[model samples]
Target: MAEQALANLHTDSGMHGRKAERFAVNRASRILSINPALSGISIRSCHLLDISRVGATISLVTTIGLSDHYYLNIMGTANRIGCAEIYRNGSRVGVKFIKEIDDELLHTIVRGDFFTAAI
Candidate 1:
């Protein structure tokens, strides 16, 4: 089942029993230009279902045309984290961050302190 797969991806031990702790963020954000050279990098809206220092689970309307690597722009901040696709099921995607984010930034995102822009 889809729910089971998602749970497997988001377990406290994480996708493969990794160390970083994940937070249930459910924050709105965007995928910035999956392939810039192909179409000048179009923005696609998505939601951060949860996040950790090393990766995140995202939900979008569709996964069509999404790339293996891209940047995730958190809605309320100027931060952009490089991501590499790990898995996909229906509207949900699992990605591993190219570089782990700092704890302060992770806390800020989890606390909803970033400046979110109008849709």
Candidate 2:
């Protein structure tokens, strides 16, 4: 039953194939979307499960059809990285950074220091 549910989400989001190296992580993040028609931005809370230099995996707090492009506001940092959805399964979704993050910031995220404001 669990597998079926995941499969449904994966197909529903249109994430069927992928090839990338992902690093395991667990952090809270905010997903931001811009609405051109309304000229507003919507925010959704999510969990960051894993990350790589190019992309990261996230699990939404609720099932919502995210835009193809969005921004991931990592907690404890003022930085917001542009991202594009690449894959999904249930609440879990994979996203690739629109631009590569600097090595220092990448290290900080991988070291699990995202909660620290020192960055």
For all candidates in order, the CA lDDT equals 0.78, 0.70
Over 12-107, each residue of candidate 1 has an lDDT whose tens digit, in order, gives 435467567666656889998646657577789999988888899999999998888889999777999999999999999999899989988887
**Weakest 10 consecutive residues, lDDT, candidate 1?**
1-10
In candidate 2, which residue pairs get closer than 3 Å at backbone N, Cα or C atoms, i.e. clash? none
Clashing pairs in 1: 76-115
Q: Give the deviation of candidate 1 from the true structure as CA RMSD.
A: 6.3
- Clash number for every model? 1, 0
What's the TM-score of every candidate structure?
0.77, 0.72
What shift in Å separates residue 21 of candidate 1 from its native position after superposition?
Answer: 0.5
State which candidate has the highest TM-score.
1
